[model samples]
Target: MDDTEILSSSEQKMEDASTESPADAIAVTHSSDDSGDSDSDSEDEAESNHQIETLESELSANPYNYDAYVQYIKLLRKTANLEKLRQARKAMSAIFPLSPSLWLEWAKDEASLASSDNVPEIVKLYERGLSDYQVCSLVYWKQLLE
Candidate 1:
């Protein structure tokens, strides 16, 4: 057979053996491969964090504005911005300490997480509350369950 005919026949044989119609032959993808990569999600996350930082900056301008302080706290928590959570807690508690119910809720959330996994964020939250707030909490008691 001619070279062109031989190659064509081989291609058809491979297509048949693989149960893929010649018209259906398309490339398969592997997730770990960097080829054809996209970064839309990372860009979105950066944009969101930037927006939150802007809001925090605006809210922080008025120290006595307790509602703004709370907005900062909620935004910081949602964005996983630990530095700002600490800062927000400090600024929020400057004239107003965390109420006992709020302290209890935060500690209870920390206490309920699974312990075996290395969850540093949760640990940081617990430590920040203990050291900075001077608010009695259940983080220690929950760890004793381990």
Candidate 2:
């Protein structure tokens, strides 16, 4: 009939259905799930952070290591650290002009996250990307049109 009544009814049903009290059952379930999830998530974050640090050090040591830059970019993208991703892209672009495919991928990422407020920024990115090419690129132009 009301919140308390409904909760009591539900707890009654749960009590009838199992040997454990409803609160105890919920507590056990949540404790197990929360601990397991947090442990795995922290481990994953640590590992990803470690990888990112290693990649950053490698890039620092050899600024011209294109493969390392690519790996760092990919890792940052995978982790969804957008600010760091932007920095990585900028660093890589400064060291070596991004390939057409790389530019397209970067544009796609920006486009996916673009809001009305950020659309102009994305447009600027596209323009910069296009200007990087020695010749006009139809693929990039089509993407911009879309």
Report, for every candidate in turn, its global Cα lDDT versus the true structure.
Answer: 0.53, 0.75
Clash-forming residue pairs, model 1:
none
lDDT (Cα, tens digit) per residue for candidate 2, span 1-146: 77798668557734542443223434544554555356754675689899999998998899999999988887676556778888989989987989887888788777777777988888888887888886788888999888
lDDT of 2 at 64: 96
Off by over 4 Å in 2: 1-38
- For candidate 1, write residues 29-109 as lDDT tens digits: 122133322364356457767877776677657577767666666555544455566566666666676654444444444
TM-score of each candidate structure, all chains considered together: 0.42, 0.68
Q: Which candidate is the best by lDDT?
A: 2
